[model samples]
Target chain A: MVTEEEIESVSKLVRIKVADHREHIEKVRDMINFFEMLDSAGVEDDELVMDDVPVSRLREDAHESFGGLSGYVREYRDGYVRVPKMD
Target chain B: MNHSSIIRASALEYVRGVTSGEFTAEEFLSETLSRIEEAEARYNAYLHVEDGQKLLARAREIDRGIKSGQKVGLLAGMPVSIKDNICMRGSRTTCGSRMLEGFVAPYDATAVSRLNAEGGIIVAKANMDEFAMGLTTEFSAYGPSRNPWNTGYVPGGSSGGSAVAAAAFECVASLGSDTGGSVRNPASFCSVVGYKPTYGLVSRHGLVSYANSIEQIGPIARTVSDAALVLGVIAGRDEHDDTTADATPATDYLEGIEGGVEGMRVGIVDEMTEGADPEVARAAERAAGNLEAAGASCERVSLDMVGYSVPSYYTITAAEAASNLARYDNLRYGYDLPLDGYEFNSYVAEARGRFGPEVTRRMILGGYVSSAGHAGRYYLKALKVRAKLTREVADAFASSYDILMAPTVPILPFRIGEKTDDPVSLFMVDLNTVTANLTRRPAVSVPYAVSAGGLPIGIQMMADSMQDRTLLRAARALEMRRPPLPEVPD
Candidate 1:
């Protein structure tokens, strides 16, 4: 079971705010308990394959911009996306 | 056709009418726009409906093409709604979250471009669960889309708006993404045809990722043939998305669609049947009976791994989502507020705080499961389970069945806020529909019956990966025998 402290830690790590830590911890614990059913799947010594996609199908390295990056950026100046100042 | 009849017509019928000169594309667009305006106040199906004049102008160009003997493509002038997650050039694609509330897409999703190439007009952007996370559209930042069949009932989602748009005749058809039953759920709820093609069958380029590996952009339409037509337009390889398979040349889905399901093997999944709503179960059984009478042999088949599908699906999707959504950091194209004198990490945290509760919850859970210490225990274990589930489904298809039949949603649509407080109960609604996503198979939902309360129930059928045509063919057979459901009163 996940405690409120763990929930807070996870929330901060994921950059999300948990309004009510107690409620969130309870909910997350319930979800994790449900996910525990995966243990019974009994996958013994099965190698984890990332995906079925063949390497040959990968797109060649090309540099064609989708264009209008400034248009989508929330704050842009001097051909760069503006972010908050780092400490 | 008059305005009412035009709105009621199937996508194929509308296209045929436009091509045959029985009605101009302009006339069809006018009728569809008027229907959208009429339905918008009550249904809230669309986040953005295209400008009336712009749509009519596009339609008029198509009409001129027909007059001049130019080839107007398959969807010729038909109005189609797109789920908000699919980027449409110059349209606001919100994915029903404030995070992207002001974001306008610069390029069309590959599916949207293909739809346009086939002459399908962009009519509107439909609402959806925020980032396609929830089973109910009530999670939408734009507000919930009511089921057209019963205004009091919730529309199963995250494609609820697309389903409602198609069901309420706001558009001839709509496109939606199914990560874990998003498309099929709403289709069942709205009494329309919702199809999720095999993963990688359709290019995922420009679809806002929730869970990339498990999701596909699919079509929701008024009829099986219309859904198949839309699928043919959208399903193909794209140079942009390497995950897509080689392009399959477009074929006439309506051609020989009426071909009966004689000698086909249909298996009713025993695992899906147990613990489902009695009414929903009866509807699935009745659909099986109809198919059997239509010349298919039917029997019950068991896939025990189905019991683990939901947990595995949620874990895998959450983990992927945590990684995929890391791109949104308030510096780029999403919700942002200028905050001076803050560290970069703190600024990102503050901006990401704008994500809604459902998204935040999933992010937290995803972070927990994929964290360094928990990765091996939860994430890897879930992947192993996913692998086992995939093998189990493949084996079932190989041995006993051409298609597996189940209820699209185990329960009928419920009232708003009924299960909002309990997240687990809400996730339980996806029990029957998540198997296809987990196994990367093709599945479709076709309306089978209406409950005594007049709510719609859909029968779900799935085929093996890349067997989209087979699944759609079976759905078409069942669609032919579907009982006439009463239209939502205007």
Candidate 2:
């Protein structure tokens, strides 16, 4: 059985902070239960092969100038894009 | 072709009427606007209708050009509703999501710009599922778009509003984004002609990304010729979208309108015959018979990997959606939460709160599918299966079949609120139509049957990748014998 702590850890890893939510735990339990049922029904890892399509990230060396100004910075200057100032 | 059931009028007819000085462009726009005003309340198809004054001004400009013997597009002065996901400069492109409730696009989608270049008036933005996420428009931040045929029933979605508007003649034609049957399923349910061009055939620039690889902007029209005409305008290479393949030669798609289908090999899928509503299956069979009578040979063909299409479609769509929607964290754009009492991670939480149940369910499912432990098990496996499915379709088309035929949706339009609570059931609603999306093939939904209640049922026909012209050619043949579109009395 997967514990709430384990589920929270997984959720946090995915950037979804749901540790304090009661409904989140229930939903996770449902998912785990579904998987467990599949396991009990003799679904095996051998039957499911993973696809290895590489996650192609933009190359670091390919730095194209953003017209000498980022859209984000432009928005900040225009008071549209907001940010926190140093206290 | 009376007021009701005049859904299949040829665009050529409209052109001839304008050119012959029978009805002015402003007259046509007024009639269309009145029709839209009459239908909008019942169908809830449009997000916002363009100002009648502005539409009249544009139409009058086109009319003046025509009177002066200047060049005009084939669909000049024709009003077209765009799906909300596609950008229209200065129009609110909410993508049916609350996060983008008032977000006006600064620039137009490539398709919108092209349509404008062809003198097509941007009529309005149609409603859709938030981010084009679900088969039913129930996932929309706005309420569900009701079916034009039966107000109590759902107009199939995520392009439901577009399909409804086209079917009801609220506009001459509309643009819809097809991601795993978004356009086709709604077209099927609404009993209109919807075409998804071969993947990347239409540029995706400025279309709000859902599943980047599978989603395509396509045309939904009352007739095949209208779809063909719209496709001609929008289907071309663009500088912004890199994925567009070698440009399919632009042709006057309406030129061969009278061409009879002789010696053409039409394939009917055995897979689509099973688990389908008897009426839908029978409709497909009837369509096949019509093709035979029209001088085309129809044969049953088996696509081996088609049975696995549903799972493969769900996996890939969900995974891509997770990544695409990750940017909506209340940071750069979209709805943001109050800064007071909010933690750093609460932005995501707030964004999640804005997501509908269907959106949340898909996010969770997609997130889980792409998780570290399950990535190899679900996401990757689905891609391999998808590749195999694509190959199966490729091999079949490479063989004797020029096109494959089936019912677009296995079932007819169900009552609104019927399947909303069950996510799995709603997902299964588009089971029959998603295969074309998975395989990156072109497909269309043409009304093949009407129920006793006068609702429209659709028959889907698909062709090989980049063979969009051929599919539209075949659909034009079917359209001649098909039933009239369902519309309200004038």
Whole-model Cα lDDT per candidate? 0.87, 0.77
Candidate 1 local lDDT, residue B253 = 59
Candidate 2 lDDT over residue span B312-390, tens digit each: 6777887898788777665545665554566656656655666766566566667776888877666766776777677
The prediction achieving the highest lDDT against the true structure is 1
Docking class of 2: incorrect
Q: Candidate 1, residues A13-41: lDDT per residue as tens digits?
A: 88775666655667887888888777777
Task: List all candidate RMSDs to the true structure.
Answer: 1.7, 4.4
Off by over 4 Å in 2: A1-80, A84-87, B1-10, B483-490
Model 1 chain A scores worst on lDDT over the 10 consecutive residues at A16-25
TM-score of chain A of each: 0.73, 0.47
lDDT of 2: 0.77
Instruction: Kindly report the docking quality category of candidate 1.
Output: medium
